[model samples]
Each structure stands twice: as structure tokens, then as C-alpha cells.
Target: MMGKTLVLVTGMVTLLSACTMMDQPKSLAFRHNAVTADPQAAGTAQVTTRPDGMVTTTLVLTGLTPGKTYAAHYHAFGPDSSTDPCASNGPVSVGFPSFTADASGRATTSVSSEMARIAGDLGAYINVHYADDLKVVPVCAPIKMTKG
Candidate 1:
């Protein structure tokens, strides 16, 4: 009888532990694309999990004018026709990086650690510069990530 009780108790403890662990939030993989009005200019981004519970993203922009500079950030929403969605949520702009185009009009950069923690209703995109301001752009809002 004692052995049976011990086995049942052990099983119950094990089950409870498993349930607790399952409740934890999971790491995620995120991806997005940049589509500009100028079909010749567009980009794609892929983010992977890192060991430190952060995400590292690799972005590639193609069909751009070579030797140009681009200012990139994770915006608040996908392609909004009206205003910059990120302007109101200043926190979203933290840890963004700037990338310069190569002779082939391709650029690459990684998203910063702070930016990786952004959750729920967030999007990412790149803006291609024409003059001092952004001329053509591609935006992906409501970025999705996978949970484990």
C-alpha cells in the first residue's frame, strides 16, 4: 500500500511540473517583407531565436538604387496610408539600426535586442530614401512570431 501511494504521489508531482513548464511563454521566429510602390525595390527580413532569449534578424533589400542609405525600424503597424504608426509609440523605435545600400542596391542588418521583446500588434519594415526624406517604402505590420 505504501509503495502504491508513493508511485501515485510521484506521478502527480511529475504531471504538475510538466503543466507548469508548459505554461511558460515560448521563443519565436519572425519574418516580414518590404514592398514598395516601385516594384523594382523591395526587401525581405527573417528573424531567428538566439541563445540569450533574444531574436536576431537578417534583412535583405533588393532592386534599390545602389549606394544609398536606408533608415530601418520596427514600426507599429503594417503599411498605413495615413501617418507613421510608430511615431505615437516611441518605445518601438528603440534599438533600430541603419543600413546602407551596396552597389547592387542590396542592404542587410540585424534587429536589436530591445526590439525583439516587442509583443502584440507590432510590425517591421524598411524605408528607402530618395532625398533627405523617405521617398519609396515597404512596410509589414502586425508581425507574427512562432511560440514553442
Candidate 2:
């Protein structure tokens, strides 16, 4: 009887430990918009989480004019998808460095953070600059990030 009781308790503990291990949270994926002034010069970004919690962002820029520099950042919300740009309700959990564009009109970057925190929500987009006007002429919005 004593041996049986010990076995049962051990089994229960092992089962509980397995359950806890399965409950560990995973990283998240992100959707981003590339904003530019040339209606043709914009696109989206897809961010995926790696096992080490670093995020790799794959950016696709279309309609680019070639040989132009763009001042970009991970903004908080999806463009008109939200009411304000600086508001806290959008997706950008943390801000990234300003990026430039190449002749083919594409650029990619990554971040090493959990990206799941409220500070890392980074909900929406990528903004590109036009060489002629030197102002942000395009805006992309409504990007999404989900647990992978």
C-alpha cells in the first residue's frame, strides 16, 4: 500500500510539471505597412518571432522611385485605422532606427525584443519619403501582430 501511494503521488507531480511546461507563452508575429508619397511606392512588412525572442521583419516596398532615401519609423497605430498617430492605442511597442531605401525600393531590419509587451504592440506601419518633395507622401496602416 505504501509503495502504491508513493507511485501515485509521483505520477501526479510529473503530470503537473508537464502541464506547467506546456503553458509557457510563445512569441508574436507582426503586420506592418510601408508608407510613402508615391501611391505606387508603398507596401507591407511581416515580422516573425524566433525562438530566442528576436523579431525578423521582412519589408516589401512597391512603387518606389529608385535612388531615394526614406525617413521611417515603427509608428504606434494603423493609419486611419486609428484616430491619432501619437496615441497609445496602436501597435508600435518600441520605436526603431530611421531606415533608408535602396534603388530597388526595398529595405529590411529586425529587432531583439519580446514584442508582445504593450510597449511593443507596434500596431501598424512603414513610412517612406519622396526625394522630390522630401515629405512623407504615403502612409500605410492597420498592420497586425499575433502569437506564432
Number of residue pairs clashing in candidate 2, backbone atoms closer than 3 angstroms, sequence gap of 3 or more or interchain: 18
Candidate 1: lDDT of 131? 33
For candidate 2, lDDT tens digit of each residue in 1-148? 9999999999999998866654353332222224434555546555565556555554556555566655444555543434334322334454444455667766544444455542333544444334345344464433433311
- Name the regions of candidate 2 deviating beyond 4 angstroms: 1-36, 78-99, 104-106, 109-112, 117-121, 129-137, 144-148
RMSD of 2: 7.7
Q: Which regions in candidate 1 have their CA more than 4 angstroms from the true location?
A: 1-38, 78-95, 124-131, 138-148
lDDT of residue 27 for candidate 1: 35
| Candidate 1, poorest ten consecutive residues by summed lDDT | 139-148
Model 1, 10-123: lDDT tens per residue? 999999887665435433222223444435665565655444556565666776567776665564444433244422332243344667778887777767454345544344
Error of 1 at 133 (Å): 0.9
TM-score of each: 0.53, 0.48
Q: Number of the top candidate by TM-score?
A: 1
